[model samples]
Target: MGSPLVSRGFQEFGSALQERRLRLLLAGRSGTGKSATGNSILQRKHFLSRLAATAVTRACATGSCRWASGDVEVLDTPDLFSPEVAQADPGFEERGRCYLLSAPGPHAVLLVTQLGRFTAQDLRAWRGVKALFGAGIAARTIVVFTRREDLAGGSLQQYVRDTDNRALRELVAECGGRCCAFDNRAADGEREAQVRELMGLVEELVRDQGGAPYTNDVYRLAQTLGGLSREERLRRVAERLAAHRELWPLAGFPSWAWPPCWALCCCCAFSAGTCPRR
Candidate 1:
C-alpha cells in the first residue's frame, strides 16, 4: 500500500544482506507453475513445465540471475512434500538433494499457486513446506500466485483483503502478509517487470529477517528434535542454537526467535483445527 522497497539501495538494508547471494526455493503442487515461475524469475527457461496428470519435475533444478551487485539463485523443486513423494528422497538422490543444492537454505521460499484456483491441496502445500523446512521457515516464506492475468489487472492486495477464503488469508497472514503475482506469459518487458517486483518483495523479506537467510540447521533441528510439543521444540531449538550460533550470528538472532531472523512459525496446522494456541 505504500512505496515499494525496490527503490532503496542494498547498502541501506539491514547488515550485509547485499554481500550474500540471495537464494530462493520454488514449491507447490504439480501444475501450479513452480518451474515456469522459476524460469520467469531467472529470465530464462531452465526448468521443465507442462500440463499433465503426473508430475513434471522429478527433482529439484537450480538457476540464478545477477541482481544489483549480487546474484539471486533459485531452486525449482518437485512436489516432494506430498504424501506420494514422501519417500522419493530416501538417499538424497531425488528431492533430498535440494537440501544440498541449497546448502545454507533459501532466503525466501516461494509457495507458488494459481490465481482463482485455490483448493484444500493448496493449504496442505504450505503445511508440507513447514514440515520439511521447519515451522520457522514460515517466517521467510512468500506466497506467489501465477496466472496473474486471471485478475484482469485488478489489485492483488485488494483481492486478498476481500477474499472469503479464511484459510488462504490466514496462510498469507502467517507469512507476514507477503505475496506476489506472476504473469509467466507476459512479454519480455512485462516479464522483467514481474521479476523485479518479486525481487523487491524478497529484499523486503530479507530486511525484515534482519538480513539473514533461513539455514539448514533449522531443518536439521526439526529432524533430530522429534516427538516434542511445539513449545518444547521451540525451547530445545533455542538451547541447541547456542551450540551453532556462529552459523548465523550476523543476523543478530536471539535463541528462541528462530530461522535466524524473526519469530518461530505458528504453523499451518491450524487448517486441520489442531493449531496450538499461542
Candidate 2:
C-alpha cells in the first residue's frame, strides 16, 4: 500500500484537475480576528482592520488563495451586529438570508474569536451569527480560536472544558466538535498544525455534503509555503522533517522536499491508492 499522504495528494490533484473553486465565508463579531485570519489564510492583507470596537467592514470582501489543489475564494464579511448597516436597508435581514442562497453556499463559515475572556457579548454575537446564517449552517461551520499564544498555558480543549460558556459549547457542538486555534503572529509548525486540522474538518464537511473532499490541507500547505520567502520555507520544511524523523523512526526519507511538499505527498499517496477515494 502507498502512504496515506501520497494518496491524499493524488486525490487533491485530481480534484484540482477538475478546476472547481471552493468558496468559504469567514464570520464572527467585531474584534474576533476574523479579518486577521482571512488575511493569514490568503497570505495577504485582503481584509481591512481597525482598533475601534465598531469599525465597519461595510460589505463582503472577497479574496482568493491559489494552491496546488485549486483556488479557494474566501469572503470576509462585515460584522453582523452593525446596527447602522442593518437599519439602513429595510430588506437587510432578507438580504442576509439571500446572501448564502445566492452563492453555491459557502463550503464553510469559520467562526473566529480571540483567546481568553469568552464574554457574554461573545455569546450574544454568536447567537446573532447563527440567526443570520441559519441554524443548519452549523453543519458547515468551524470555530477558529485565534491568538493561541495568549491562552496562558491553557489549551482550547481545557478552556472549553473549564468554561460555563454555554454559547461556545453549543457552537462547537453545532460544528460537530471541530475547533482549531491559530496565532496570526507566528508562522511556524504549530500554526501549520492548526491549518491542517481546519482543512481536515473542511474535508469531513465536504464528504458529509455528498461531494468530493477538497483536501484543503494541500491548498493550505501551498498557501502557507507560498507566503514565505524561499529560504524561510526551506528552513521550516527542514525543521519539520527533522521533527518527524525524531518522532517516527520507521518513516522513510521524504520524497517531496520542495516548497509544496504537503501537496506532493498527497498527490503521490492518492496515485498509489493509499487515500480514500470517497
Candidate 3:
C-alpha cells in the first residue's frame, strides 16, 4: 500500500486529468426545481430547496463542484418567463442577469421542467429564453426534465415522442431533440450517473460547436458589462435581477416589501453555500 498522502495526491492528479470546467445555466418556472437541478448537477445540496408559493430562488444563485473528470458551475435563477414576472415586472429580462452571472457565458443553458407538467408558463419560459438568447441558442440548449420517477417505465425520449402536448413536442424539436431526465430524489449513485449522461451530451454539444457556447447580441452586451469593475458589474447584475420582485402583487405583498425580500435573498445565496466560487 502507498502512503496516505501519496494516495491523496494521485486522486487529485487523476481529477486534474479529467478536469474540464463547464458553466451551465438552469432555467425554468418557479417550482420546476431549478435550484434542485443545480444541486443535482453539483452533486450536493448547495442551493436552497423548499416548497414555496412564489419564486424561491429570488435571484441568480451560482454553485460549483467537481463531477467525475469535470468541474461544473450551475447558475440557477428565478423564473424569467413566469407570466407573473413578465406581466408584473417588465424590467426583469426573461434571461435576467443569468448570462452576466455566467460571466464569459455558459456552455449550455439547460431548460428545466417537471416531468409531464409542461404548462403554458413553461412555453412562455421557452419563448423567454429564445427572446433573450436568440433561436440559435435552441441548438445549444437541452431540455432537462426533473422527477424521472414519474415517467413510469418509459424513457424521456419516448415520453416526448408519445406525449399529446404539442407545445412540449415542439419545444423538444427546437432543442434539436436534445433532452435529459433527472430524479432529484434519487440515490447518490443514480444521480451522479444522470449527471454524467448529461455531461456526455454537453461534451458532444461542445464538440459540434467547435468548443464555443451559444451567444448573440445580448451575450455581446453582457460581455461589454464585463469590462466594468468586478464590484460594479455585480451590482449592476443584482439590480437587473432585482426587477423580478417589483410585481409580486399576486403574492399579496406590497411593492415596498421588496427591499427586505432582496436582502433575504442575498443572504440565502451566501448562507445556502451557492455563492459563486472565486
Best by lDDT: 1
In model 1, where do residues sit more than 4 Å from their true spots? 1-15, 90-95, 216-278
* Residue pairs of candidate 1 with colliding backbone atoms: none
- Model 3 lDDT, residue 129, Cα: 65
- Predicted candidate 3 versus true structure: per-residue lDDT over 1-278, tens digit per residue: 11121233333533543235667888877798888888887777889988887778777788877544446678888766554554644654434456677766678889998886676557667766665556687888989998888877687888789776666888889888999999998998788678767876776676677666566654565677856876666556545455434334332334463333222221133423453321
Q: Residue-wise lDDT of candidate 2 within 50-117, one digit each (tens)?
A: 56656557666788866445667788877653323334333343333224322535777788876654
Name model 2 segments beyond 4 Å from true. 1-19, 81-85, 93-102, 152-154, 188-190, 212-278
